[model samples]
Target: MLKKQVSSAIIIVLCLFLFPTIISANTNEQLELYSEAAILIDAQSGQVLYEKNSQEKLPPASITKIATAIYAIENGNLDDIVTVSENARNAEGTKVYLEAGEQVPLLKLVQGLLINSGNDAGVAIAEHLSGSVDEFVVDFNRYLEEVIGVENTHFTNPHGLYDPDHVTTAEDMAKITQYAMKNETFREIFSTKELPWDGETWDTTLINHHVMVRDGSYEGVTGGKNGFVTEAGFTLVTTANQENISLIAVTMKTMYDNQVYEDTTKLFNYGFQHYETDTIDMNSQFVDSEDNQYKTVENIYYTKKIGEIVEEDVTTSGKLVIKGEDGRKLVEKKLELVTNKEKEKQQIKNETIYQTDDNREQHLRIIIPISLIISFLIAAFFFKQTRKI
Candidate 1:
C-alpha cells in the first residue's frame, strides 16, 4: 500500500510537470462571437484587439461601399457632374432610383451609395470614374490590395453585389474601413444618418441602412454599413469613437442580421473596456542609461491594456522593437543615433530574444556561450562541494 501511494504521488508530479495552466488576457473569455468571421481593430493605431477567423475570405456585401466611397473621393473629381447611363439605372439590388441620363455630381453619387446603400450610385460612380465596370473593378482591386495594404480581399464590384470571386475577409474590411475613416469627407458621408435627396425618380430623405446607426440604439457609433445576400449572409462594418479612442469592428457571414450586430457590439465593448491606443513620437529623442540619444524612423502607434506597459528599446543594428508583456512584437522601426555613432553602447535584457526563425542563429550565438559558462560554473561548484563533503 505504501509503495502504491508513492507511485501515485510520483505519477501526479509528472502530470503536473507536463501540463501547466495558462492564463490569457482576453477578459471576455474569447467572446461568444456569432458571426463566422469577425475582427476588431484600433482605428488610429491599427492594432488588432480581437479576431475570429478574421483572415477567412467571405462576401462583404455593402461594406464594400466603404472601399468604393474612399476610392471615388480620392481618385474621381467629386465636383464633376456625371451623366447617369442606362447601365447605372439598371443596376440590380438597392438603388437611389437615378434616372438614365440624369446628371449628378460625383460626390452626390458617393453620398447616395453610402447613405442609401444605392447599387445604382455605385455603378454610376464606377462608370464615371473608370469608364466601365470591368476597368473599375481592376483599379478598385489594385487600390484595395496595393494602396490599402490588404492581401485577402478581392473585389469584383464596387457595390459589393454577389460575384463568386468577389470576396473580402473581416480583417481586410476593417482595415479598409480604418483607411476610409481617415478622410474627413468619407467620415462625414459615412456618419450621415439622414440626408435630403432630390433625385429624378426618388425624392425622399435618405437614411443610413444600418439599423444600429440609423436608430441610435448603439451610442458612440460614428458610422456603420450593413449588408446581406443569399450567398454572403449578413455582413456589417462599424466605426465608433469612445474616450478619444477610435475602433473599427467588422463581422461577416452571419445567418441572421441581429447576430452580426451582436458580434460587433461584443467586439467593440471588449476593445474599449480593455485596450487603449497610444503613439510614440519619433521626433522625440530617446536617451539610454549610458546617455546615448536615439530617434525612431517615424511615429508609430500601439495598443495595450490600460495597466499594461509596453517596452521599447533600440538594438545594436539600430532597430527599434516594441513588445507587449508577453514578449510579442507589436512593431519595429529603424532607429538613428543622434550623434551618428556606429555602435550601440548598451544592450538590454531583450538581446536574448528569439522572436523569429530568421534571428534564431543570431540569438543562439549569444545564448549558447552564456549557457555553457553557467553550466561549467555550476559543475565546478558541485565538484568542489563534493570534494569538501
Candidate 2:
C-alpha cells in the first residue's frame, strides 16, 4: 500500500518557507483590546483559540449585514430585479441612495450592502426577499438559528441599526462568519475590496470599510465586516488565512472604531500564531482496545496549539474523542461502525496505503483518523492587532 505521509510532509514544509514568522502572545492578558468582548477560532475546524467575554450578548451594529448578505445569496436569485420601496429609499445612516420604485438586481444590492455598508441596499434586499422588513426578520432569524446554528444572535433588521433586541455575541458572530466563508459567492463578496455600483440615485465605487482589509496593511487578511451605532458602539468580524489554517475573529462594543480593529487583530494574531489545523482523512479507519472498528463519515478537522501533545481514543459506541495530554476533552466526533459493505469501500480507498518503518514517529496532532491511531505534528504563529486610533 502507498501512504500519503510523504505528500503531507511536503505540504507542511512548503508552507514554512512561504509565510513570514508571526509572534504568538504569551498569555490572554497580553492581548489588550478595548472592545468589551472578542473571540477567535479556527475557521475550518471551528476550534476556539482565544476568547474574552465571547458569549456576552451585545449589539452587533452593521455586522448584522453579514447574516443578511449570506442569507440573500442562499435564498434569493442574484439576477432577480427588486423594486425599491420608500422605506428602503429613506433608510438612515450609510446608504447607496436607493430610489423609490427603482429597479435593481439582488446581487448588486448585496454588493452595495456589504462593500459600501449601504443601509438602503440592505433594506431593499429585505423587502425584495421577504416582502417587508418585519417578515424578513422572522425568516432571517430562523435561517441564522436553524441553518447557521447561531444561538445567541437575534437580528431585528436586515441592516444592523441600533436596536436593543438586535444583539449577538462575539462567539456567535465568529460562527456566522465561519459558515458564510464556506460559500464561494459569500466569500467572494466578503473579501471584495472595491466594486463599481450603478445606482438609481447614486453612482460610485463601493469600497470596503474594513480599514485593514481595504488598506492591505494586515497579512492574510481575506475578508472583513465593520459595524457601529450609538448603541452598539463598534463591532467587527474578520477572516484571515495562514498556511492551511483559516481564522475567524470577532470584536464587539469598542469605544472607538480603531479599537475594534485592534481587538480583531489581536485575536487573529493569537489564532494564526498559536494554532494549526489537522485533517482526518475519510478513508482512514480506527480501532479500540476492544477491537471495535469505526470510520469517519467525512473529512474531519481539529486545531491545536504548536507543540501541544494530545490523544485520540475511539469508543465502543462509535464516537471519537480527542483530548489534551492532560486528559481534557478538546474535540469529539461521532464515528461510523465498520460494516461489510463499508469495509469494502474503505478498503478500496486505502488499497495503496502502507505503514511506515518500525522506527517511524507519530505525533498526536488534532483529530484526523488516518490510521489505527490519528497522529501528526502541529505548529503555527499568531500576532496581536491593535485598532489604530
Candidate 3:
C-alpha cells in the first residue's frame, strides 16, 4: 500500500510538470485556419506567439506600402514639397487624382496614401524621393534588405499592386509592420481612423475595406493595411492593444474579406487572452565601480528584465562570475533574494576597486618611474636649449 501511494504521488508530480508544456505545444500547433499564411506577434517584444506557413512567399498588395512609407519617412523630409509627375498622376488604381506639376507637401501625400489607399500618392512619393519610380523601387528593395533585414521580400513598385515578381512572406510583413510601428509618425498615420486633406475627407467608414476597424469589437484596434488582388486573394494586417499589451496579426490568401478579419481577430484574441509577459530578473551588476574589490561600493544599478517567457512556474536566478586580470574566474557570486520584490529591483553596487596584489603594484610602480624619467629628459632638453640661447 505504501509503495503504491509513493508511485501515485510521483506520477502526479510528473504529469503536473509536463502538462503545461504539452498544452502550449498543442496550442501553437493548432493555430492554422483558412489562410495560406498567418502570424501573431507581441508588439512590444516582437516575439512570435503563433505562426502558420509564415515564411511562404505571397504577393503583399497595399501592405507593401508599410515599407515604402518607412523608407520615405526615414530618408525624405516630410516638409519637402513633392511635385506630381505625369507618371505618378496617372499610375493605375485607387488614385488621389494628383495633377502633373501640382506641388503637395510630402506629409500630405503620406496621409493620402495610407488613409485612402492611394496608388498615385505612392508613386509620387517614390518619384520625388529617387527621381523615377523604377529607381525608387530598387532603392526600396535595398532598404528592405539593409534597414529592415527582410530577406524574403522584394518590391517592384512603391504601391503593392499585383506584379508577378513583387512578393513578401506573412512573417516578413509582420516584421515590417512591427518595425514601422516603432516610429511615432508611422504609428500616428496608421492608427488614424479618419483624416481630412485637400478639402476632401478620407474617412474609414463602415464601407471601408478593413472590417476590423469598421466593427468595434477589439477595443484598442489601432491601424493596419488591407489588400486584395486576384492573384493574392484577401490579405489583412491588424494591430490592437489591450491593457498595455499590443499585438499584430497577419493573414493571407483567405477566401473572403470577412474570413480575413475573423482569422486576424482570432489571432489577436488568442494573444491577448492566453499569452502574457512576465518580467524575469536577470543578473544585476555594479556599474562605475571605483573600488572593484570592496563591499562598500556605491550601488549603480545595471538591471535588465529578461525578454518574454511564456511559462508561469519557471523562476530564474542569477550568477555573477568575476574575472581576474588574466580573464580567469576569480570569484563566483550567486544572488539570493531577501524579499520577492528585491528580484524585481535592479540594485547594483558601484564605486568599488579591486585590491592590487604585489605583482600589479610592481608593474604600476615600474611604469610610473619610466614615464617620469621620459618626461624629465624631455623637459631638460628644452631647458638646456633655452639656457644656451
* Candidate topping lDDT: 1
lDDT of 3 by residue, 266-320 (tens): 7877777665543224433322222121121222221111222221111234333
lDDT of 2 by residue, 43-161 (tens): 98898888889999999999899999999999999999999999999999999888999999999999999998999999999989899999999999999999999989888999888
TM-score of 3: 0.68
Task: Give the runs in model 3 whose Cα sits over 4 Å from its true position.
Answer: 1-26, 199-209, 278-389
The positional error of residue 26 in candidate 2, measured at the CA in angstroms, is: 3.3
**For each candidate, what TM-score against the reference?**
0.80, 0.79, 0.68
92-168, model 1: which lDDT tens digit per residue? Answer: 99999999999999999999999999999999999999999999999998888889999998899999899989999
Order of candidates by TM-score, top first? 1, 2, 3
Summed backbone clashes in each candidate are 0, 15, 11
Model 3 weakest 10-residue run by lDDT: 296-305
